[model samples]
Target: MKDYDDTTWFLGQWGRFQQTVFFLLCASVFPNGFGAFSLVYLTDIPSHSCLVPDVNLTQDWHKAIIPIKVVNGKQEWSSCSRYRLDVVRNLSALAYVPGRDVNLTDLELEACVDGWTYSRDVYQSTVVSEFDLVCSDQWKQPFTSTVYFLGVLVGSFFSGQLSDEFGRKPIFFGTMAVQTVFTFVAIFSPSWTVFCILLFISGLGQISNYISAFVLGTEILTGNVRVLFSSLGVCLAFAFGYMMLPLFAYFLRDWRSLLLALSLPGLLYLPLWWFIPESPRWLLSQGRVREAEAILREAARKNKLQAPQIIFDNYHVDADETEKQPKEHLSIFHLLKTRNIRNTTVILCMVWFTLSTGYFGLSLNTSRLHANPYISCFISAAVEVPAYISSWLALRYLPRRISVICILLLGGVSLYFIQLVPQSLSELSVALEMLGKYGLTTGTALMFVYTAELYPTVLRNTATGTCTTVSRVGSCIAPFLLQLSTYLKYLPYITLGTLAVASAFATLFLPESFGRPLPQTIQQMYRRESSLKCPFITRKKPSKAVVLSESKL
Candidate 1:
């Protein structure tokens, strides 16, 4: 029987139909860029001091009311503590000035019980300032990001099965709607709890929309076009959206306004439903050959070509034979049922987890960089454009394993070396951090293409979803990893760097899939063989059955 690629060759790669699907799908992912990392500005903790009410006091006493603590070799007003207001008032009445007649250090300190006066020099307002998520409550800020990733975790868990069960178009648009509606509604949340709950729900749709677009593109587009779409098309769209985030945040400093700006772009994607078609490969897998053929005919028409009347003659037979088996048996457990697949899944999971951790850790930590938060974030998002371009080139030419290893090591080394840069050369530190981000972004873009190529058509969505779901675990931990910096300034970098390098080594175990046809069955999955010269360089040949099946094409 002819495979999906050969069977649908009439559609022509890079034709009008492919171009329409490619651009529209990429456009669909634009909102996700900002939606994923908006929390950076939304939850930012600006410079704040305890809010002291007006009392009969000298200017020195008013300034001295807030305790001073040395941080990083410089004395600054304490954000969380202040001298006792009653003591300051009494001292002022005695005609005694702070540090003149009385030592300011002698005054007792108290928590910011009254409230905090947040500086508006950077952000007009953030979730941290609005909800007073400062001092002891500061933990909630990072936890808020974690909560959204937790939603991504849950959404990724089911997105695969849902996409596979239904068609790709439905799930893609459906999740986009879910994300948009929830994010829009979240702006009106009365409390942090309500906001978090809405964020979690929106997260479910965010990743699902992204994954669905990926799978749909990979399934519909063929050969180099598929590789390009996977590597640059979808990823750069996301990068563009991500880049737009800082621009929006730069203008809209208020958390609610920024969120509302992010939420509104999703509405622009609603028109895409009519333009993007469902994945025909998925249609054929479900024994819906007629529907699949109809889509192909329309594609052929759009491309100004004639498709044969009997497009899926052999495919129909193959689909019917496969349909005899019970559908319920094809669960995620099937991935682990075979040794070759099990090994691939395990290694890929580890790689995904580590990459996700490093990617999001650096992304979310942009606000903390020793630069303007807006510029830092903009630079962070901007770097991804070239990173993905590099990824596209690598995916198109290099072997998958070597690409993964080199990029991972680049990220790891750059991040690990950050601590060695002298404090005086703070610019070098930021440069190393951006370099690390560049490497990870390239690695992340390549992984999507690599993973899609490794799995069979039947299990592709499930496998991709599983890997992303595992990666979300790393994302969920990412915000807290930044929190580690409070104790040891370079802790997050050291940990993320170590994990990236370790995962690079893990990639050595997986078989290469570049220049090989995507497998259609578990039996066709790449298995380790003693005949290969170099594990990383050599691409494994398909089994005899798959070879014979493709020869017929």
Candidate 2:
């Protein structure tokens, strides 16, 4: 019997019906993009120093309380320490001058026992300011982002099975609501602990909605539209949302207000519940024949076409003859059932982990860039446009393995060289960092497409979800990785760069999947072989005769 793709040709592939679903689903992804990285602005460390007590003192005496220390070769007031209050009080009692009689350096220093003053120049309010998550609590700042990603990891793990068991539409709408409601609630969190808890829950919902929408689009659309929607539609919309985030943060400097602004947009997506249909493929897999038929009929009617009167007629006919055949329900463990499949799964996991690490690490590091954080973040988001376009075009033309390796290597090399850039030329360093991000974004786009092509349909979702879970492990640690700079300044970059390059080599071991049809069974996946000559640097095209022979097989 013909597959669903063949059977559904009459429903109109790229018609108005499919286009509506594609764009609306893509719209759902926009908020996720912003939400995923909002922590960057939310947790940003504004200029701060220990709050000096309000006392009538000379200008010189005022300066003495917050002593200047040379940091990174630049003299700046100490943020975590201040002159001992006893010494300052004694000097004031004596009515002595600050520099003439008193040696400020010789005086003991102490932590900000009273409170800290914050600079409102860049941000009106941030989590750092609201909770005083600086100095002793500075570690908590990056921990918040880590907690969010841990939630994403949990979401990715269960989203597939839950959607597969329930239905894509319900899971999609439910997760979207959870993400929106929790995010808004987080704004009112009374403590950092509460905010982190809400943030983690929001993450679970965020990834669930994202992956569900993605799967729904792929199942509903056909041919090039599926590729476009997955690679360009949702991906581009995500980039657009990311770009909009810095703009929103730039205008709304208060973190609570910015979060409110981000969460409020979910109201626009509520209408999609009425419009986006359940995935007919998923419905059929669940043996919900009537539901699948109804959706197909609606799709045909909207596209101004006619579906087969008996939608399941062919499926029933095929099932009747194959009644004696045992149906296989593959799980994640099935991925390691064979040597080749197990190897592919391991390599893909490494690739995914490295890709996610580099992507989030560079993205979160925008504040470290020399330029204004808003512009730096905007540039980071903007660079994805060309990077994604390059990825989309490369997937259409170039060999998949070659594209993955080249971009990974490029990103890895650039990240390593970023250490060589002199701090004096901050612009040059920022440029190299953005360039590395470009490569990382391209690799991210390519890996999703390549993984889909690599696995058999029987275990594709299982494999993909598993890889995504592994990637989130990297994402969870990414913020902590940034915190490592406290121990050694370039540790984060060196770590991510090394992983990217190592994963590039790992990509070389995986089979080339360009221009290949997806396998439908574990047997087919095992029997598959690399068609590309070198599977490394070479990109020779197969002859027409060879292509025809392979198709005949």
Candidate 3:
């Protein structure tokens, strides 16, 4: 029997049909680029000080109202504390010069009683400024990002099962609508609590649609076209969207307006429904052979070629034999049923967790860079372009395991070196950080492609979603990881770098999927010889049933 790829070979790769699906699917993910990281600007904390109420005071007294404290070595005005207003007023009446006549340190300090005043140099308004989520409430800011990732975590758990059960196209578009609508509604959120609720809902849609689109595209396209779409095409579209976020935020400068701008673009994607089609492979897996054939025929029509009268003549449907077996609902647990897949799942989970920790940790840290947040964010997003291009090259030419291991090591090493640079060469520090981001970005892109290929169609989305679900745990903690830098400079880098290097070493245990046909069933999953050669484990020969199944494929 011919495999799906062999059966579809007549359609040709890189034709008009493949290009259309590639671009449209890539376009579908464009909004996800900006939507994922809009929190950087939405909750941005700008230069600020305690708001002083109107009172009779000298110029020096007004300046004296804000207490100065040493940060990193340089004296800077305290953002949360201020001189007691009553003391400042009395000092002003005494004609006391803050530095000349009286020592400012003698004055008592108090928390901002009235409110806070933020400089509009960077952001005109943000959640941080509007809600005063600073000082005592400062923890809310990072918690907000954590809430969003929690939503992503929950969404990842169900997206694969839902897609596998219902179909990819509906879940893809349905979740896109969920993300768009909730984001639009969030712009009008009256309080942080309300905004967080909406953000959580939006997150549920965000990652679901992202994974759905990824699986949908991978299943629809074949061979190297699949490689390009997975590695460069979809990722670059997302990076472009991310790149555009800072530009929009730079002009808007208000959290609500930036969110509005981000949410509205998703509406443009609704038209894509007609242009992109469902995965024919997924359709066949569900026993909808005719529907799958219909989609392939439409693709052939778009490619301006005539599909054969009977498309699935020599193709075998795995579902056909199990039609009367009560239709078992496959889940993530199925990935653990066998040793080969169980090992793959365990290693993939580790790789994904570490990758997410490094990638999102660096991405969210962009706002804290010693430069304009907008430019820093743009640079961060822009760096992914080349990284993804490099990923495409690596995915095309190198073995999957080597590519992942090498890029992960690059990220780990670059991040580890950032602590060696002096403060005077801050530019070099930023450069090394970007290089770390570059390496991680490339690894991330490759992992997306690599993970999808590791599992058979029956468990592809579930396995991918499971891996990404685990990754969200890393993302969830990434905000708190950034906070560690304040207590011990470079602590986050050291931690993330160590994990990256460890994940690199772990990659050696998984089988390489390079230049091999995607496995269509659990029986056909690629197994590495080294796994069997482990010193502590007993090697077993393949069962007759497994060998017979492989022979049939």
Candidate 1 ranges with C-alpha deviation above 4 Å: 316-329, 526-553
Return the lDDT, model 3, position 402. Answer: 89
TM-score of each: 0.94, 0.91, 0.94
Compute the lDDT for candidate 3.
0.87
lDDT of each prediction vs. the true structure? 0.86, 0.82, 0.87
Lowest summed-lDDT stretch of 10 residues in model 3? 527-536
**Per-model tally of clashing residue pairs:** 0, 0, 0
User: Which whole-number lDDT from 0 to 100 does residue 443 have in model 3?
Assistant: 93
TM-score computed on alpha carbons, candidate 1? 0.94
* Model 3 per-residue lDDT tens digits across residues 1-553: 1299989998999899999988889988988998889999998788888999889999989977898899878999999999889988988999999998888888789998899999998888999998889999999999999999999999998988898778889999999999999999998889999989999999999989999999999999998899999999989999999999988998999898999999998899898888888888877777678998999998899889999999998876445333322234578877776556677899999999999988899999997675788888988998999999999999999999989999999999999999999989988999999999999999999999999888878778999999999999999999999989888899999998999999998888777788988866655564432234433356678676655543333
As a whole number from 0 to 100, the lDDT of residue 63 in candidate 3 is: 78
For 432-538, candidate 2 gives per-residue lDDT tens digits of: 88889999999988887788768754455667777888999999998888878879887888988999899988888788877665554444455464342443466
Using lDDT, rank the candidates from best to worst.
3, 1, 2
User: Candidate 3, clashing residue pairs?
Assistant: none
| Model 1 lDDT-worst window of ten | 320-329
Q: Which sections of candidate 2 miss by over 4 Å?
A: 316-330, 456-458, 529-553
